[model samples]
Target: MELETIRETYQSGRVVLINKPLQWTSFDVVNKIRWHLTRALQIKKIKVGHAGTLDPLADGLLIVCIGRATKMIEAIQDAPKEYLAAIDLGATTPSYDLETEIEQEYPVEHITEDLVIETLKGFKGEQMQMPPAFSAKKVNGKPAYEYARKNIDVTLKSKKVFFHEIDLQYFEPKHLKVRINCSKGTYIRSFAHDLGQKLNSGAYLQGLTRTAIGQFTLKDAWTLDQYIDKINRLNKYKVGEL
Candidate 1:
């Protein structure tokens, strides 16, 4: 579609899939898109929101809704999500991911490929999961990470989440790669943390990529540069129209 046509649709509403860059928070994507659209369309304001929140350390598909489409954010977020995650065995961090420094290490000498495969099976289906302390989950109307940073302890309850599939893609002594398809609210960081405990070795999320959210795939999403270029094109076209 032409940039102008896209801009026109966006004024009312449109669902855009963006390939989120690593280290950029989900809000970053929304803000960027909104800023660009407002400039391209010469509009005073634009309603924009994201369907799901991707961690700053992860990258891949992010569903963005503009204008009236923002109302569908809840439905979009409820859909299943898929992720390619790299789990680091034998070491753990306070956040269960590289967002925090490793606080402890364990022996991986006893871990084997067969054992890892067997252990993965245990995570499939419905289970209760405790979200990481350094997460966006709210506690007493404040983000959990806020309290965690203050060195305050808060008891977080477990939530039910379902894992439809857990495909082990690779395995080594201390590195494991897996593709996970799970329900909403399923936290991959927590999964890695729990897996380490089950294996008698510490583990944390070394890497993560959100490959899909429902029918939206990273392959169809626009890169930040591409999105900006299109917006520029639209703005130029708007000048021609005037």
Candidate 2:
């Protein structure tokens, strides 16, 4: 793909797949790409938006819409998502993932392979799920995380979500790894919290990597560095040059 072609495509509107890095929020990826695109094309501003939000502790495919393609954001966000997650047994956290420190611990000695498999089966199909308190979901015009940061308690309602698949990839006495295929509003963090209660032991999301969004897979996505380097090369090219 040529530099000019990439710029022109984005100018006309295109969907870009980015493999988001850990510790960087979804907005971080959007801002980085938007900055590079404007510089490469010498545009003062260009509309850029992300289709879905991924937590800072999570890494994986993020669909970015450029120019007029931003209009598809709501539709794209409604698509199903796939994730590979690691859950650490015997402990729980306020935020449900590593984003928060462990607040409690429980015995995992009774957790076994059969028990884990059974639990996985239980989560399959449709159910009501509560979003994590530390989430982007809005609460009375303000984000839930904002209220949480102020130590204010807010009641978040449960939303209906479907888990099409839950494949167990690995299991141990203290940890379990699984690939989950679920609906749009599903929150793995809250799932982790619920899983602990089901097993009568505590659990928290130890790791997570989003592998797919609708038909877009992480394998077909570009890393942030890759996008940046390509943009740099494009910026070096002069007018009328390839």
Candidate 3:
């Protein structure tokens, strides 16, 4: 927990649980940590990476691996993930989220609480899912979003993904919220888009927060400020010593 201890162990490896802030990419969090740690530990460079990539529109629990711990990224990414997602019904977007403008709208008048609950149940278990075009999923050696940004039509392949659980937490006429527990590579954005189709309506992701990954929970993660302040304090103490 002390600065000296962290510096000594950093090369060996350290796993940091960060509560990633909204509008910040997972890589942003990694870069910030690496920058501070490099300066604090007086190291020339340090390896840092995140286990999974969270969208800029979403926030919460991001696992950052430092030094030797970077090797664990693959294993950590394979862990099951949990999310709290807010979905906007009766609307659809090209990105299946707020990143893109709504391109269509459908009727939510026929949708009811009972129907929503039943529809959510159908999503459980193994099913094929298509990742959103605005996602980091690679296509032809470039992120799918590259082509999507260029307005280039690109066919995407659907992959088998399993939904461990999908619980409707709240529902309204035009919006609903759910807590989802799913396997690796599951995209909540795509799930939102697909749910609308199944209900004979349209929907898009309004907001999202990753709550957990394997055993790591958002509750146990540190905010960027918290970690930065700690590092700064240690740096001040080191200066005092000198």
Best by lDDT: 3
In the range 1-242, model 3's lDDT, one tens digit per residue, is 45566576667887889999999998889999889888988888999999989989999999999889999999999999999999999999999999999999899999999999999999999989999999888889999999999999888999999999999999998999999999999999999999999999999999999999999899999899998776666645542231
Q: lDDT, candidate 3, residue 143?
A: 94
TM-score of each: 0.94, 0.92, 0.94
Give candidate 1's error at residue 40 in angstroms.
0.8
Candidate 1: tens digits of C-alpha lDDT, residues 58-144: 998999888898999999999999999999999999999998899998999999999999999999999999999998899999989
Model 2 segments more than 4 A misplaced: 1-7, 235-242
- Misplaced by over 4 Å in model 1 are 1-7, 235-242
In candidate 2, what are the lDDT values of residues 1-242, reduced to their tens digit? 55556667667777888999999999999999889878887778989999989999999999999888999999998989999999999998888988778888899999999998998899999989998888888999999999887889999999999999999899899989989999998999888889888999999999999999898899999999987786677756654442
When sorted by lDDT, best at the front, the candidate numbers are: 3, 1, 2
